[model samples]
Target chain A: MKIYEFAQAPNCRRVRMFLAEKGIKMEYVHVDIGKGENLAEDYRRRDPNAKVPVLELDDGSHIAESVAIQRYFEEMHPEPPLFGRDAKEKALVEMWTRRGDFNMMFNVGMCFQHTTGFFSDRMRVFPEFGEESGKKAVQFFSVLDQHLEENRYLVGDYFSVADIGMLCSLDFGKAVKLRPDPAQYPNLVRWREELNARPSASA
Target chain B: MKIYEFAQAPNCRRVRMFLAEKGIKMEYVHVDIGKGENLAEDYRRRDPNAKVPVLELDDGSHIAESVAIQRYFEEMHPEPPLFGRDAKEKALVEMWTRRGDFNMMFNVGMCFQHTTGFFSDRMRVFPEFGEESGKKAVQFFSVLDQHLEENRYLVGDYFSVADIGMLCSLDFGKAVKLRPDPAQYPNLVRWREELNARPSASA
Candidate 1:
C-alpha cells in the first residue's frame, strides 16, 4: 500500500501516528501542499476533495479521510487495536475521536486557514471566523482537561485513536498559537506531555 | 436503550434514520434545544458537549456523536448493514460519511448558526461567515451531484450511512435555503428525490 500525505498536516500526522502505533509500514508518497500539487487533476482523481492523507491499497483503490484510513488499517490489523476491543469500547473510542475532531482538530484547522490565509489562493478566509474558531479550540481544552483529570486517556485507561486524534489536534493547535495554558488546564497540559513523549509522537 | 435528541437536529436525525432503517425501536427522550434544556447541568453530564442524539445504553452509560451511536447500532444489529458488507466497502462508506460531515453537514450547520443566528443568544454570529458557509455547502452539492451521476448511492449501489448523512445534511440545508438546483445539480436532485421516497426519510 502507498499513502499520499503531506508531512506536518494534522490529518496526515494522524494516519502516521496510527501506523507507528500498530508497527505497520507502507510506502509513503508525499503530496506537497506547499506547491499546490494536491490540487492538480491527477491528485484530485485519487481524492475528489483534493485532501492529503489518502491511502492507496495494492488493488489501486484509494481511501480518503484520515479516520477512515485508520479504520481500514484497524480492520486489517486487529492486534493492538486503536479503535476498541468490543462494542461499548468501540463506541467510547469513536465518541472521543469525534469529539477531538469537532472540538479541536476542525476548529484549529479553521483558525489557521481563516487567520493565516494559508491557502487563501484556493479558498476564502474570514478573519473573524478564524479568531472565533481559535477561541473555540481553546475552550475545548478546558473540557478535555476536566475529562483527563480522572481518566488516564481520552477513553479511560486505554490508548486509542481518540488519544491519537487529540495529539494531532493539539500539535496542530500550535499553528494558530492555540495552546492550553498550564495554570488553567493542568490535566490537559500533563496529558499532552505524556503523549508527546510517546515514540509515535515523532512520527 | 434511550436516545436523547432534538427532533429537528440534523445529527440527531441521522441516528433516527439509521434506527428506522434497521427497524429497531428505542425509548426517545426529547431534549428541546430551542428551550435551552440541553444546556442544563444534568444534560451536560450526559454529554459534555451538550449536543443532542446521545444514546444511553442499557448499562446506563451513554455514547455521544451520531456516527458512534450508529456504530453501536450497527454492531448490535448486523442485518441490512448500513456501514458495509466487507472491508473495502466499509472504507468507502466511511470515506463518504466523513465527506458528508465535512463538506456538507458541517457547512450547512455553520450557515444556519451564523446566518439564522438560531443560537445567537449563546454564541457569536457572523453573517459573512454564515453566507460563506452557505456558498461552500452549495459548492459541495455539485461535488455530490457528480459522484451520484456515476453511483446509485454515496458509496456505491447499496445504501449506507453515507446516504443517511447526505440526506440529513440536505434536509438541514433547507434551514439555510441551500438546496441543489435541478438545473445545476441534476444528479444530486435525483438522488435526494429517491432518498426522500424511503420510509426512513421521515425519521
Candidate 2:
C-alpha cells in the first residue's frame, strides 16, 4: 500500500498525523500539487478528483479524502482508537471531525485559495467570499475556545481524529493570516499548545 | 430517542431518509429554522452549532450532524449497511460521501444561501461566490454523469449513504434553480430517477 500525497497540504498532513498516531508505516509517493502535477492525466487516473493524499491499496484500488483514508487505517489498526471506542464516542468524534473540516479547514482553504489565487490556474478566485470565510473561521475559534474551556479535547478527554483534524486546519490557517487571538481565545490557544506538543503534530 | 429538526432542511431530510431506510422510527421535534427558532438559547444548548437534525438519545445526550447521527444507528443496526460492509468498501463509500458533500451538497447550499440571502439574518452572503458555486455544481454533475455511465451507484452496484447525500443535495438544488440537465447529463438524471423511486426518498 502507498499514499500519494503532497506533504505540505493540510489534508495530507491530516492523513500523516493519523498514520503517525496509529504507528502505521507505509510507502509514500509524492504528488507535487504546487506544480499542478495533480492535474496531470496520470494523477487524475489515480484519483479523478485530482486531490492529494490518496491511499492506493495492494489491489490498485484508490481511496481519496483524508477522513476516508484515515478510517481505512483505523479499521485495520484498532489499537489506540483515534476514531472512538464505542458508538457514542464515535458519533461525537465524527461530529467534531466534520465540524472541524467544515468550519475550520474549508474556511482556511478558501481564504488561501481565493485571497492568494493559489489555484487560479484551475479554478476561479473570489476574494470577497474569501474575506468573509476568514472572518467565519475566526468566529469558529470563539466557539472552540468556549468548548475547550471545559474539555481537554474536542470530544471528551482523550485525543482523537477530531483533534487531529482541527490541529492541521488551525495550523494551516497561518497561510491565510488566521490564528486564534490568545487574548480572545485563551482556551483555544491552550488547547492548540497541548496538541502541538504531541509527536504526531510534526507529521 | 427524538430528533430536533426543521422538516424542510436538506440535512434534516437526509437524516429522516436514512432513518426511513433503516426502518427506525423516532419522535420528531420540530425546530422552526425558517423563523430562526434554532438560534434560541434553548436550541443552542441542545446544539451549540445551532444546526438541525440533532438526535436526542434516551439518556438526553445529543448527536448533531446528519452523518454522525446516521453512524450512531449504523453501528447499532449494521444491516444492509449503508456505510459499507468491509474496510475497502467502507473507505470507498466514505470517499464518495465526502465527495458528494464537498462537490455537490456544499455548492448547492452555497448557491441557496448566498444567492437568495436566505440566511442573511445570521450570516454574510456573497452572490458572486454563489453563482460560481452553481457552475461548480454543474461541473460536478458532469463528473457524476460520467461515473454513473459506468456504475449504477457512486461506489458500486449497491446503494450507500454517498448516493443519499447526493440525492438530497441534488433535490435541494431546485431551491437554487440548479439541476442536472437531462440532455447534458443523461447518466446523472438516470441515476437520480432510480434513487428518487426509492420509498425512503420521500422521507
Candidate 3:
C-alpha cells in the first residue's frame, strides 16, 4: 500500500502523524502540489477533488481525504484506538475532530491560500476572505483554549485523532502567521507544548 | 434521548434525516436560531460552539456536530448501517460525507452567511467572499454531477449519511439561490430528485 501525497501539506502530515502514532509505516509517493502535479489529469482521476493524501489500498483502490485514510488505518490497527474506545467517547472524538478539521485547519488553509496566493494559479484568491479566515481560526483557538482549560485532550484525557488534527493545523498555522497567543490561550499553549513533545508530531 | 435543534437549519436537518433513515425517533427541543437562541449562554453551555442539533444522551451528556450525532445513532442501530458495511466502504462513505460537508455544504452555507448577512449581528459578513463561496459551491455541484453520472449515491449504491449531508445542503442552497441546473448538471439533478423523493428527505 502506498499513499500519494505532498509531504509539506498539513493534510498529508495529518495522515503521517496518525500512522506514526499507530506505529505503522507505509510507502509514500510524492505528488508535488507546488509544481501543480496534483491538478494533473492522472492525479485528478485518482481523486476527483485532487487533494493531497490519497491512500492506495492493496486492491489498487484509492481513498481520498486525510480523515478517511486515518479511519482506514485505525480500523486495521485498532490497538492504539486513536479514533476512540467506545460509543460516547467515539462520538466526542468525532465531534472534536470535525471541529478541528473544519474550523481550525480549514480556516488556516483558506488564509494561506487566499493571502499567500500559493494556489492563485489554480483557484480564485481573495485576500479579504483570507484575512477573515485568519480571524476565524484564531476564534477557534479561544474556544479550544477554553475547552483545554479543564481537559487533558480535546475529547478529555485520551490522545485521540482530534489532538492530531488540531496539532497539525496549529503547526501549519505558522504559514499564515496565526498562532494561539501564550497569554490569551494558555491552556491551548500548554496542550500544544505537550503534543509537540510527542515524537510523532514531527511526522 | 433529546435533540436540541432548529428544524430549518441544514445541519440540523442532516441529523433529523439520518435519524429518520435509521427508523429511530426522539424528542425534539426547538432552538430558535432566528432569534439567536443558539447564542444564549445556556445553549452555549450545552454546546460551546453555539451550534444547533446537540443530542442529549440518556446519561444527559451532549454530542454536538451533525455527523457525530448521526454516528452515535449509527453505533446504536448498526442494522441499517448508514455509515458503511465494512472498512473499505466505511472509508469511502467517510470520504464522500466529508467532501459533501466541507466542500458542498460548507460553501453553500458560507455563501448564505456572507451574502445574506443572516448572522451579521453576531459575525462579520463579506459579500465578495460569499460570491466566491457560491462559485465554489457551484464547482462542487459540477463535480458531484459527474460523479453521480455513474454512481446512484455519493458512495455508490448505498444511500449513506454522505448523501444525507449533500441532500440537506443542496436544499439549503435555495436560501442562497444556488441550485444544480438541470441543463448543466443533469446527473446531479437526477440524483437530487431521487433522494428528494425519499420520505426521510423532509425530516
Candidate 4:
C-alpha cells in the first residue's frame, strides 16, 4: 500500500498515527502541499480533491478521506482494534469520531482555509472570512475540553481513532492560534499529553 | 428508536432517508436548531455536543452524527444494504461517500454556517469567515460536477449511501444559491434525475 502524505497536515498526521499504532509499514509518497505538488497532474489522478493522505492499496484501489482510511485500517487489522469489536462499541466510536471531526477538525480546517489562504489559488479565493473561521474554531475547542473532562479518551476508556483524529487538529489549532487554555481544558490537556507520550502520537 | 431531528438539515435528512429506506418507524423529537433548542439542557443530555440527528436506540445506546447513524442502521438491518458487502465493495462505497461528503456535503455546511448564520445564537456566530466557507462549498460543487459526468452514481453502478449523501447536499445546496448548472454538469443532471426517480431517493 502507498500513502500520499505531508508531515504537517493534520489529516495526513491522522493516517500516520494510525499506521504507527498498527505497526503497518506501507510506502509513503510525500505530497508537498506548500509547493503545490499535489496540484500537479500526477497527484490529481490519485485524488481529484487534491488533499493529502490518499492511501493507495496494492490492488490499485485508492481510499481518500482520513476517516475512511482509518476505517479501512480498522477492518484490515482488527487486533488492538481502533473501532472496537461489537456493534455498540463501534457505533460509539463512530459517533464520537464524527463529532470530533465535524466540530474540531473542521473548525481547524476553516481557520486555515479561510484565514491562512494557503490553498487560496485552488480551494478558497476569499481571505475576508478567515478571522471569523478562526473565532469559531476557538469555540469548538471549548466543547472538546468539556468532553475530555469526563472521558479518558474522546469516546471512552480506550484510545480509539477519534482520539487520534482530534489530537492532530487540536495540536494544529495551536499553530494557527486556536489553542485551548490549560485552565479550561485540563482534561483535554491530560489526554493530549497521554497521546503525545505515545510513539504513534509523535508520528 | 427515537431520532432528534429538524427536516431541513441535511445531517438530519441523512438519517431520515436511512430510516425511511430501512423501513424503520422511529419516533421523532424535533430539535429546533434555529431556536437554540439543541443547546438547551434536555437535548444536550442526548448529545453533549448539542447537535441534531441523535439516534437513541431502544437499548439506550445513543448514536450521533448522520454517517454514524446510517452505519448503525445498516449494521442492524443489513438488508437492501447501503454500505456494500465485500471488502472491496465496502471500500468503494466509503470512498465515494466520503468524497461526496467533503467535496459537497461539508462544503454545503460551510456555505450555510458561514453565510446564513442561522444557528448564530447557539454558537453559529461570525459571518466574515462563514461567507468564505459558503464559497468554498461552491468550489466543491465544481469537483462533483466533474465526477458525476463520468460515473452513474457518486461511486459506481449502485445507489448506495454516497448517492443519498450527495442528493441531500445538492438539494440542500439550492437553498444557498449553489445549484449545479445543466450547461456545466450535464451528467450530474442525468444522475440527479435517476436518483430523484428512485423509490428511496426522498427517503
Candidate 5:
C-alpha cells in the first residue's frame, strides 16, 4: 500500500499517525500542495477531490477522507482498533470524531481561508467570509472546552480517533492564531497534553 | 425512540427517510432552530453541539451526526440495509456517503450558516462565513455532477445512505441560490429524479 501525503496538513498528519500507531508500513509519496502539485491532472485522477492522504490499497483501489482512511486501515489491521470493538463503542468514537470534524477541524480551515488570505491566490473569492471562520473557531474552542471537562478523551475514557483528529487540527490552529487558552479550557489543556505525550502524536 | 428534528434541515430529514424506508416507527420532537431553541440548556444536554437530527435511543443515550444516526439505526434493524453489505460494498457506501458529507452536505451547512445568517445568533457570533459557505456548496455540486456522470446512484445501482445524504441537501441548496445548473449537471438531474422516484427519497 502507498499513501500520497502532505507534511503540514492536519488531515494528512492524521493518516500518517494512524499508520504509525497500527505498525503498518506503506510507501509514502509526498504531494506538494503548496507548489500546486495536487492540482495537476495526474494527482487529480488519484483522488478526484485532489486532497492529500489518499491510501492506495494493494488491490489498486483507494480511500479518501482522513476519518475514512483511518477506518480503512483499522479494518485491514485490527490488532489495535482505534475505532473500538462493539457497535455502540464505535458509534461513540464516531460521535466525537464528527464533533471534532464539524467544530474544530472544519472551523480551523475557515480561520485560515477567511482571515489570513494565505490561500487566496489558490482560491480568493471568499474574502468576505474569511474572518467569520476565525471567530467560529473561537466558538468551537468553547464547546470543546466543555466536552473535555468531563471526558478524558473526546468520546469517553479511552484515547481514540477523536483525539487524533482534534490534536492535529488544533496544532495547525496555532499557525492561524487559535490556541487553547489554559484559562478558558482546562479540560482541553489536560487532553491536549496527554495527546502530546504519545510518540506517534508527533506525526 | 424519539427524534428531535426540523423539516427544513436535510440532516434531520435523513433520519426520517431512514426510518420510513425501514418501516420503523418513532415519535418526532421538532426543535425550532430558527428560534434558537437548540441552544437552550434543555436541548444542549441532549446534544452539546446544539445541532439537530438527534436520536434519543431506547437506552436513553443520544446520537448526533446524521451518518452516526444512520449507522445506529441500520445496526438495530439490518434488513434491507441502507449501508451496503460486505467489506467492499460497505466501503463503497461509506466512500460516497462521506463525499456527500464533505463535498456536499457539509458545504450545505456552511451555505446556510455562513451565508444565510438564519441562525447566526444561536450558532455563534459571526454571519459572514455564510457567503463563503454558499460558494463552497456550489463548488461541491460540480464535484457531485462529475461523479453522477459515471455512477447511477452515488455508489452503486441501488439506493443507499449516500443518496439520502445528497438528495435532501441539494434540494435544500436550491433555497440558497446554490442550485446546480441543469445544463452543466445533466447527470445530477437524472440521478435527482431517479432518487426522488423512490418512496423514501422525499423524506
Candidate 6:
C-alpha cells in the first residue's frame, strides 16, 4: 500500500499515527501541498478532491478521508483495535471521533486557512471567519477538557481513533495559536501531555 | 429507542432516512432548535453539544452524530446494510460519506449560519464567508457529478449511506439556494432525481 500525504497536515498525521499504532509499514509519498503538487492532474486523478493522505491499497483502489483510512487499517489489523470491539463501543468511538473532526480539527484547519492565508494562492482567505473559527476551536477545547476530566480517553478506558483525532486537532491548533491553556483546560492539557509521550503520537 | 431531532436539519434527516430504509421504528421527539429548546439544561445533559439527532437507546443511553447513529442501527439490523458488506466496501462507503459531509453538508450549513444568521441568537454571522461557502458547495457538486458519471453509486453498484448523505446534503442545499444545476452538474442532477424518488428520501 502507498499513502500520498503532507507530513505536517493534521489529516495526514491522523493516518500516519494510526499506521504507527498498528506497527504497519507502507510506502509514503510526500505530496507538496504548499507547492500545489496535490492539485496536479495525476494526483487529482487519484483523488478528485486533491486532498492529502490518499491511501492506495494493494489492489490499486484508493481511500480518501483520514477516518476512512483508519477504518481500513482497523479492519486489516484488528488487534489493538482503534475503533471498537462491539456495536455500542464502535458507535461511541465514532461519535467522539466525529465530534473531534467537526468541532476541533475542522475548525482549527479553517482558522489557519482563513487567518494565515496558508493556501491563499489556491483559495480565498477570510480573516474575519478565521478569527471566529479560532474562537470556536478554543471553545471546543473546553468541551474536550470537560470530557477528558472523566474519561481516560475520548470514549472510555481504551485508546481509539477518537484520541488520535483529538491529538491531531490539538497539534494543528498550534498553527493558529489555539493551543489549550493549561490552567483553563487542565484535563485536556494533561491528556495531551500523556498522548504526546506515546511513540505513535509523534508519527 | 427515541430520537431528538429537528425535522429539516440535514444531519437529523440523514438518520431519519436511514431508519426509514431499515424499516426501524423509533419514538421521535422534536427538538425545536430554532427556539433554542436544544439548549435547555436537560438536553445539554443528554448531549453536551446540544446538537439535534441524538438517539436515545432503549437503555436510556444516547448516541450523537448522524453517522454514528446510523452505524448503531446498521449493526443492530445488518439487512439492507448502509455501511457495507466487506472491509473495502465499507471503507469506500465511509470515504464518500465523509466527503459529502465535509464538502457539501458542512459548507451548506456554514453558508446558512453565516448568511442567514439562522442561529444569530447564539453566534456571530459573516456574509462574506457565507457567500464563499456557497460557492464551495457548488464546486463540490461538480466533483460529485464527475464521480457519479463513472459510477452507479458513490462507491460502486449498491446504494449506501453515502447516497443518503448526498441526499441529505442536497436537500439542505435548498436552504441556501444552492441546488445542483443540470447544465453544470448533470450527473449529480440525475443522481439526486433518482434518490429523491426513493420513499426514504422524504423521511
lDDT (0 to 1) per candidate: 0.90, 0.90, 0.90, 0.78, 0.78, 0.89
Of the candidates numbered 2 and 6, which has the greater lDDT value? Answer: 2
Regions of candidate 4 where Cα sits further than 4 Å from its true position:
A120-128, B59-61, B120-135
- lDDT string for model 6 (B1-203, tens) is 79999998999889988999999988899899999999999998889999989999889998999999999889889898889888888899989999998898889988999899889989988898889989999888888898899887898788999999988987798988998879988898888888889999887
Candidate 5 collision pairs: A114-A130, B114-B129, B114-B130, B115-B130
Candidate 2 chain A lowest-lDDT run of ten: A41-50
Better of 4 and 6 by TM-score: 6
Fnat by candidate, in order: 0.67, 0.70, 0.67, 0.43, 0.33, 0.70
Shift in Å, residue B122, candidate 4: 4.8
In candidate 4, which residue pairs clash? A114-A130, A129-B129, B17-B203, B111-B134, B114-B130
| lDDT tens digits, residue span A38-88, model 2 | 899988888888998899989887899999999888888888999888889
lDDT of 3 by residue, A4-40 (tens): 9999899899999999999998999999898899888
> Which ten residues in a row are the worst by lDDT in model 3 chain B?
B71-80
Clash pairs, model 2 backbone: none
TM-score of each: 0.98, 0.98, 0.97, 0.91, 0.92, 0.98
How far in Å is the alpha carbon of B55 misplaced in model 4?
1.2
Place model 5 in a CAPRI quality band. Answer: acceptable
Kindly list the per-residue Cα lDDT of model 4 for residues A1-203, writing each as its tens digit. 78888988998889889889999887888778888998898888888877788989888868887877877876777668987566767777778777677777776776777677777777644444556556766777677778777788876787888788888888888767887778877877888889999999876
lDDT of 2 by residue, B47-111 (tens): 88899989999998899999999899998887769998888788888899899899999999999
Two-way DockQ contest, 1 vs 6, winner: 6
In candidate 2, position B80 carries an lDDT of 67
By summed lDDT, which 10 consecutive residues of candidate 6 chain A come out lowest? Answer: A70-79
